[model samples]
Target: MPMRTRDSSGRRLATLAVCCAIVVLVLAAVAMPVAGHAYLSDSDPANGDRLEALPETVTLEFSGDGVQVADVTVTGPDGEDVSGDAVIDPDDDRLVSVSLERDDTDADGIYTVDWEILAEDGHTTAGSFFFSVGDEPVDRESVLEAYADDEDDVSIATTAAKGALLLAVVALVGVPVTAAVAVYPVVGRFGVAPSVVDRRLTRVLAGAGVVLFGAVLALGVARSASIGSSGLSLEAIRTFAATPLGHVWLVQLLVAALVATGLLAGVRGSLDRRYWLGSSLAGAVVVQATVSWTSHSATLVDRLQGVTVDFAHVAGAGLWLGGLCVLAAVLPTVLADAEAGDRDRLAADAIRRYSIVALTGVTLALLTGLILAVWHAPTLAHLAETTYGTALSAKVLLVVAALGLGGFTRFVLLRRLDPDRERSALERRVRGRGSSGRGSDGRVRENGGREAGDDPTVDETASTTSTLVTRVLSLEVALLVLVVVLSGLLTSTPTAVVAEQTDAGDPVTLEREYDDGIVELTVGSPSVWGEHGSAFVDEGEPVVFDVTFTSASDGDPLESDRPVTILAHNERADTQLQFDLEATEEPGTYSTVQTLPDPLWWELRVSGSPEGTYVSEWVDVYAVPDGHEHVHEYAPLEETGFTHLLRIGAIVVGITGSLAVAVETVRFGRRQR
Candidate 1:
């Protein structure tokens, strides 16, 4: 081995170590308690309360800390404002209040309260409720219909910006990882040094870095435009800059600069070759970590765990899918430029090395992906019901397609590229006859004016095999790019399980303890039912149950098990049913799907044996109307017209692109077969 090759190996190890250390730091530091959107926990003169006398002041308490009231209004039956300015409590930021300006002269039937709050993390939540003060009680449905802001449309430009940023990160990080772990080492063994590939690949790295920097800037502008009451104004930008989300953007900007500058310096030959590779890799990890912070993972209850899994997930994607992209871009060019004799060895070795790296990355991505899906959806109903679920489902389908393509590549295409097999066949054919050196056809043949041991037939076979592998890898790369974009959409969209309950209605919760006092169970019924006209579930529709088991002594979640047994009795129809619940990836959470065959009144009895002791828990009754379709309806806003088009367009494009990739993959498989 040459000294330069030894040095290159040492540098690769060092680069990998630096990346691992940076990942650890990210997992620790990003857990600094970034808050999620604030939700109303309780309010004075509570929602739909029929009060004989009006109160002096109305107060609201929220679920998240550091929440500040942005706007509040109280409307009387006569359609006039009758409330003072909203004020945040000094002792508890999550508490807000506004005094009523009503008088004896005022005649009231219904009073409506509407408010919007901004959480510390910069996202806003707004809602409406009603109270009655006269002989007529509050009509909840009427109030909601008149005052609720029904626009739930996500901004198209923002999601696009996010997708672009995600793609840029994958490209920027992926090239370096692929080169270090897969390309450089194998090529160097065949006498193609890292310095040699660096000279040829510098422009590609620089281009990826520049794209990433631009993407970071685009995300900031898009985010500002998408904010409420702050459409890209300087003040709006300043306000955003003061929040935790703004801080994440700032960090993204800095890291993007680091990555672009490092790669550019290497391209310009201004940085030391020994240090640039490691520095660029370390910068890539930081970029990926910052990108994870901008996702919905930051909104999870366990912010640290969510962020960590997200980081690992994207990093693995960068390694496998991103690396495939790098290979697709570089390998063909390298093969085209290499001497014919060297091409076979180079392609074979490079593919073999990258297969292992791709395998590692794919494994990490799939495992983390499963964890994230459970955290976001929790149940099949959630996966099928929400907008977030729709995007995730689409992404999962694409991933399955990619996995099929990858499986064929690894097991079939790659195996055919075995250089040793081709060489062995050539040798046997050339040396088949004992003294005469006749070919495999049993006839003496001339070398055809070609060099000894050079067979055109074997060379043609190697070239064809290499070409097939390249085409398949290219298709796989394209598929993964779509996956990354969908991942971006997922980050911007609300979680399937959490958001479904918020918009649909509050889920009913039941709690009970086991006889041994070692286990406690908390079960949350589905949000398919609501008071007034907002109800969702109909007869014979699937209902999901979210169950959690906790240790009685410590109040911590108990170990996961198959311990839940739910029995439902329809008192009106004299029908009863029993079923079991399955555990979810979330530590102590379990979920199951069942259907209520009849409408109107039903009672539930939940039981479990978590600690070798059976515990029966009492749950509340549920009501559903018969012969009604279970459908979710979103109220549209005037401003959401273009944004809605953009969102719909994105979905259409994703579906179309995925189908095209699948068709091409299938065609390619048929050709190989």
Candidate 2:
């Protein structure tokens, strides 16, 4: 009776183990890839070059994703005012162009360009550069590009290191959880494989949390380097360290140490303390929360959604992988015993229970994954067209395949292998075979020996089958990791889109030489001509300009097509008025405006030409605060505050969420202990 009872328990436990293993394997195979692949590449102006004239647009290029141009600014020499317009390229969503007014280019000095680009992968890259105009010399020693280069290098290094660490942690933690679930018959009373798997997986998830914490620290260093700023002073460190992101690394380090210690102690048989388990579990949860901050989950609402999805993702992965470990190691051992019937029954029961749990985990994984996609992507087009989206699709497909396998194992195989009925039939077949060649007693002995002895063929077949299944599941998990790495890359801006949309077409120069004695003015308009006129302007209007002057050679009223007149309006008004002077008949410079209405208040006025008129000779004209007398130019492109905030917010949220998860995990462990 005692042996039978033990056999029954063993069989039930094996069944539970198989079921949990199936579910955990499926989840891991699906979720990890979806999380890793996000990043950025390429930018406009080609890094560094001297421009013949200022470019009206700035664009960026990416390998496989798309980007949103957040902002662009141009500051001229003397830090004075210049005519410039910033706007998105109508033809491409990724490009951002800025157009400067022709009149504002009078100052000959270096111009600084600063910009920000947001990638589809939910991260942002921002930096500044400078270029010389006219006769101004370029600064050869500037480290702006070096800083930008550092940003990319540091980000890649940090992400890779962190990702590797996370993978290791997940694997280590999952091992124990899998073992626990597999050995549940010996450990617990009920068929709660799903709950057990979940609990164990959660504890192991702390490994990933710790890895994420490391990533946050690496990112901060990268950010500081990119900015060309230094001073790891207490204040600087505190400023960064105090944030949810800064503390994530510190927390992860502590949690990792604790988890390692606990795991080692447990392995050595010295740590039977339940607190170790609790601490490990709590630490993992904290890590999950802290790492989430590095994602787009900084705000309360986003964080809540992120937390829910992340939990599902993490827990699902653990359960799937851990369950597989059990099915491979523990189930067969219990099945090959003398009281095979009872052992088989227990194993079958456990398998049945585990199937349900795995199904639930897979379901949660799918739902949460979809929610995350919807929240972050926001558009179907983005999902279909972006690199991030493509990786996500691949991950989804793998998950479906895993689910299908699980379904086959559950509904078809489990039902057919019904221990209550099948055991009897199998027993009859074996007994009959044995009886055909021997006496009843001899046949019974032969049957018992066959069941008890370890035959190479039977063992080989079972191991081969289990190994094949495990290999397939492991492949799925590996693909998931690739998907995650791609996701990280996708988060970076798409240089191609930005380049196409924001590149300034060609420069159109219109020059007019006026014989003004007092002012030898060679008025010129460097207009940006593109497929669309507004590509080079801020007010979403075409680039337009006007230049006018008066004659200083002769202090006499000049002739006009209709008449010649001078009305002195102010002391600063041009003393000599000339109109219709013998200037060459150019399309934009045919006629000139001369005259003033005196008390010396109103200056000479030229009407009728869209590009404005130029005086034939040099004449001093008074500068007016609100006057349009000299030359007026306009480039139409406008930037809104909302767009700026949106891009900035995305970057902040992503970085912050990643760090927060790390810190929370540490705090959780401390409290638990």
**Global lDDT scores for all candidate models:** 0.63, 0.41
Estimate the TM-score of every prediction: 0.66, 0.48
| lDDT tens per residue, model 2, 599-637 | 223333332222233333222222223223211111111
- What does each candidate score in C-alpha RMSD? 16.7, 17.2
- Which ranges of candidate 1 are over 4 A from the true structure? 1-38, 52-57, 63-70, 76-109, 117-124, 134-141, 146-153, 190-196, 272-276, 427-452, 503-673
Q: Return the TM-score for candidate 2, rounded to 2 decimals.
A: 0.48
Clashing pairs in 1: none
Error of 2 at 358 (Å): 2.1
Candidate 2 lDDT at 28 equals 27
As for model 1, its CA RMSD to the true structure in angstroms is 16.7
Q: For model 2, state the Cα shift of residue 271 in Å.
A: 1.2
Instruction: Estimate candidate 2's alpha-carbon lDDT, on a 0 to 1 scale.
Output: 0.41
lDDT of 1 at 158: 61
Model 2 spans with C-alpha error above 4 angstroms: 1-110, 115-124, 129-154, 165-182, 186-244, 299-301, 325-350, 412-418, 424-537, 540-673
